[model samples]
Each structure stands twice: as C-alpha cells, then as structure tokens.
Target: MQAHFDAQQRQRSKLTELGLGLSIDIVAALATSAVVAPFVAIIDRSIISNASGRMPLMAGLQDGFRTLATRPAVLARQPSVVAVFSVYAITYITANASETIALSANADPLLPKFLASSTVNIAACVYKDKLLTHWCSLGPARPFPMASYGLFGLRDSLTVAASFSLPPLLSTMLQSNTSMSKTSCDSISQLALPCMVQFISTPIHLLGLDIYNNPSATAVRRAQVVRRDFIPSTLARMGRILPAFGFGGLVNNKTRTTLKRWIL
Candidate 1:
C-alpha cells in the first residue's frame, strides 16, 4: 500500500498539475467575485452615500471612474459601489469566456480577453449604468454617450481582465506562479502566492485604469477628476482586493482538500 501510494503520486504529470492549477485559479476568481465585490459594494455605498446621498447616477459614475483610476487613485473622492460591482461582474464573465476560447485555439488568452473585455464592457455599461434612465420618473432625461462607456470599459475591463489573465504580459511581470508546487498546490502557503501576486499588482491595475480617464474628449475625460491621495487611497483599494483574494483561496483550498481526503 505504501509503495502503491508513492507510485500514484509520482504518476501525476506537469500537464495534469497545470490543469489543477487552472482549476484553483477559477475557484479563486469566483470566490473573489462573490466575496470582494459585495464587500467593496457595501463600503462603496457607504462612502458614496455620505458624499452625494443615495443617488444611483452619481454613485454609478463615481464607481465607474474609480474602477479605472490610477494607483493612489483619483476616483476616491467620487466613489461609487454599484459601478465597481458592475465592472467586476462583467470582466469576470468576459475573462472566463475569452480564456476558454484562447485555450481552444491554442492562442495566448490575453488577446482574446483584451478584445472581449473592450467590447463587452460597452454592453455592460449601457445595461449596468443606472445613471442613464429613459424613464422620466428617475430624473431629467439625457443622451447617453456610448463613447465614454467604451473608453471607461476599455481601461476598467482591461485591467480587470488582466487580473485573472494568465498570459504573463509585460505589465503582469510582477505576477509569479512560483507559489504553486505540484505536490503542495492546495496548501495555504501555495494559495497565498496568487493572492500575493494580486496584491502586488493591485497598484498596476489601478494605474492602467487611470490612463483612459484622461487625455481625450471622451465622456470619461469629461468627468470630474480628483487628486489621488497616494497612501490612503491605495490602502483603501488593498483592503478591498486582499481580503477577497485571501478568503477565496482559503475557502477553495480547504474545501477541495477536505473532499479529496474524504474520497481517498
């Protein structure tokens, strides 16, 4: 029995290991989605409410701005929770679908993700943006500039899409898969590696968001731009991302290990 167990362990190949690794990433992504998005939403609503009241338009716009702000983000002043959640959800689906297509075609996932995120973001913006209400009951009617949404979605969705994207672009050089070992992939220490990558890259992600918000006549650039608070602003974002990534990793690792242990 001891020899058989050892033999079975050795039989696991790197390709199999990669598959397992990808599965963990998916679970972690979903877990982060479920936890972080809601957690940030609550905090976001509170912050936006304190400043602009419970108005959805103001909040969504603020949320959208923050979704694409630079590190030491400028969007903190106009914070909106709904916009953040909307972006997060849309990017999550886009990333998943694009990744599948990339794998099927044996191409780098980044290109597909970039394209899909850039496009679908527009759709998500139109539907998810609560600010533009055609119904007279909400407020004064206004023309929706689909251009701004596309630009905002491009930056926001791209950064978000990059978060889960495994292509290891020049931008994601900071991300390291060194944490996951074939033998200990499910360990807490291993799980923490991906979260650490996410933590390190958080600022980079925000900075990418900041780019499209400026330097153009697009609606995104037209919105009120605030000064980034540096340390405090970054800490606020870290608080949102770190907990979600860490908790998601922990939950998935534990659940998977428990089930496997039981079965074996």
Candidate 2:
C-alpha cells in the first residue's frame, strides 16, 4: 500500500512539473514575441518586397515603419506580422518544453532542442516564405513549386542549428580560450552565428523565391536572378535573421530561465 501511494505521488509530481514548465513557456513566449514580432515582420516585408521587385529595399523599410507609426492597426493586420508572431510563439513553446524534458531526464539537450525547434521552424518558414513572396509580388499569386518547400526546409534547418545548437557550443569554446565572461561569450555566439549563417541560407531562400516567381525560367536565368539580387538580399536577410533568431532567441531563453527559477 505504501509503495503504490509513493508511485502515485511521483506521477503527480511529474505532472505538476510539466504543467508549470509549459506555463513558463507560454509566459515567456508571449513576452518575447510581443517585442520581437514587429521588428521581424518589418524586415521580412522589406526582404520579400525587394526579392519580388515590388519596391526598392529602402522604400520598403520606410514604408514598414511609416505604417507602424501612422497606421498601427493595419500593420498588426499584416499577414507577415501575424506569421512572425506565430513562429516566435511556437518556437519558444517547443524549445522550452524540449529543453525542460531533456534536463529532467539528464540527457544532452542540444540535439533534442534542435529537433524540436527545427520541425516547427521548417513548416512555419516554408509557409511564411511562400505567403510573403506571393503577397509582395505584383504578379498574381500562383501555386508554389515543390522545390520551394524543400529549399525553405533546408534554409530553416540551418537556421534552427544556428539558433538552438551552435550558441552553447560556441560559448563554451569561446570561454575556454578567450577568457571572456560567460555573458559576453553567449552574446557573441548568439548574435554572430545566426547572422553568419544567413550568407548560406539567404541564397537558398532567394533561389526558392525565383523558382516560385518564374517557374518556367531556365537554370541560367534563375542563376542570373539570384546573382543580381544576391548582395542586397543577403544583407537584408542577415538583418532580419539577427532580430528573428539572434535577439529573439536570447530574449526567449532568458525569460524562460528566469520564470523557471521562480516557478519551477
């Protein structure tokens, strides 16, 4: 009888911990997304606008802020803004839940964290890419090619690695040799890795957009389009990625850690 009572208590305790952890994730995601989403949306709008040749980059940026300042309601209503918020919110929920579970089980968290976030990131990013590209283009929207999904999935996998996996490893390496403070090491790793990864992922993203916009364009023409927009699009993506993954990831991590200490 005592053994069965103890087992029930253990199960209850586990359930309570999970509930509290999920609550922490919800709070952290809400707080972080509130700040990060608008910035991410603004940059996303600019990048898609430039890629679609709908407007110059600078003009797209100005228009983003101007809309925020003058017509905040409309900015809130934008599909880009809604998508960005959803990604940030869902990412935190999954990442925090996975990390909490791994820690409780005394397992390495890096792989589980990467897997948890990458799955959602790939799906959400593919949808967002196609939606934003179509919305930004002056041309009528068309069905997305199958290749576009694969390209976005690849790009987002890299992003998930940079955001979730590389930072802790890089921070540890930086601390071991550089004598940097842990906070400084973390900041540098979190900021630099995700931004640098944009170099590789941005071209993949642009090529995907080209495929969507010009399905019949030859390989030579698609390559030309990528080359033409490569520099500006890469720079813009680096900017967007820093806010979306770098800064946003930091904010979500800190918030969840703080709340876990307080609540869990």
Model 1 reaches what TM-score against the true structure? Answer: 0.43
How do the residues 67-94 of candidate 2 rate in per-residue lDDT, one tens digit apiece?
9889988988888899888888888778
RMSD for each of the candidates: 11.2, 1.7
Q: Candidate 1: misplaced stretches above 4 Å?
A: 1-32, 50-90, 121-151, 165-167, 170-225, 228-234, 241-264
Alpha-carbon lDDT, every model:
0.44, 0.86
| Model 2 lDDT at residue 260 | 81
Model 1 over residues 1-264: C-alpha lDDT tens digits? 999987787666534644554554455445545555545544334322322223443454465445545432333333233455555555555555566557655787777866775566546544443242222113354454455444444534433443433323422332345544443433343334434454344333333223322334344433322223223334454444444333443454454455435533
Candidate 2: segments with Cα more than 4 A from true spot: 1-7
Give lDDT: candidate 1, residue 260: 37
Worst 10 residues of 2 by lDDT: 30-39
Error of 2 at 199 (Å): 0.7
Model 1, position 57, has a per-residue lDDT of 32
- Looking at model 2, residue 250 earns an lDDT score of 85
State TM-scores per candidate: 0.43, 0.93
